[model samples]
Target: MIITGEDIGKKFGKTWIFRNQNFEIQSGEITSITGKNGSGKSTLLQIIAGYLTPSQGTIYANGDQIDEQKHHSVFIGPYTEVIEEFTLKEFLNFHQQFKKPVCSIEEMANSASLPLDKMIGDFSTGMKQRTKLITAFFFENDAIFMDEPTSNLDDEGFQWWKDLLKKIDQRLVIIASNDQEEIKCCSKQLNL
Candidate 1:
């Protein structure tokens, strides 16, 4: 898969967040977007993932125009919220209703070290990040977008993430982060 953004830009009201950005991201590679705070790294990632629309220009996936509703990308970010009221099992079941999981429920639960009956609201910050990462990684998708993926992770959790990243194949991975270790995983980068 190839994602091409042409002269992309985004604005909130009259304030432009980013402008005149262009790039082509292909499959089987990890790409990072880096910038100081509020430099639009997350915005660009959101636009590429089809979660946010660009105020100007267009994006294409494998030569076809990208449609947010129909796009088959998995995005995990701090701003992306899960149903805190649901148990892990309930949330997994709910998610499976829309998209079939690549792993079994038991496997996912084990991999994330999550109790099946535990409520998401009760999970620690690290646990939640683990849950989100597992959910995104366990799905078969064309693209994966991660914004500040290691925000709440501890040393062990950080290593776990690095190990997990090695297992990714073929899919296009786009990460928006400032972590040096995380940025090193990417073969290419887009600096905002």
Candidate 2:
């Protein structure tokens, strides 16, 4: 898969978050969007994931224009919502209805060290983050977009995140973060 952004820009009201940015991201590469706070890294990632529309220019995936409703990418971010009302098992089952995971639900739960019967609402921040990562990494998708992936993770969880990345080395992975350790794995970087 290839994602191309041509003169992409985003603005809210009178202020421009970012403008005139261009990039070409391809499969089998881990790309990091690096910038300081409020530097539009997350905004740019959202635009690429089809969660938000750019105020200017265009974004294309594999030679086709990106459509918000039809894009087949998986996104995991601080703002990405999860069904807190469902148990881990229930949530995984529900997710399976939309997209098949690369692994079984039991394997994902075990790898994340999360109890299948536990409600997502009851999980700790780190656990929830793990759940999110597991869902994103263990799913079948052409592209994966992550924003501050290590936000709530501990040292062990951080290592787990890095290890998980190794398993999906052939997929198109895009991350928006300021963490040096997290960015270390990326071969291509777009600094805002």
The most accurate candidate by TM-score is: 2
- Each model's lDDT comes to 0.88, 0.90
Of candidate 2, the 10-residue stretch with the lowest lDDT total is 64-73
TM-score per prediction, in order, is 0.93, 0.96
Model 1: lDDT of residue 151: 85
Report the lDDT of model 2 for residue 84.
98
> How many pairs of residues in model 1 come into backbone collision?
0
Q: What is the lDDT of residue 114 in candidate 2?
A: 89
lDDT of 1 by residue, 1-192 (tens): 999999999999999988999999999999999999999999999889887889999999988778733656789987778888999889988888877688898898887778999999999998889888877788777789999998888888788888888888998999999989999999999998
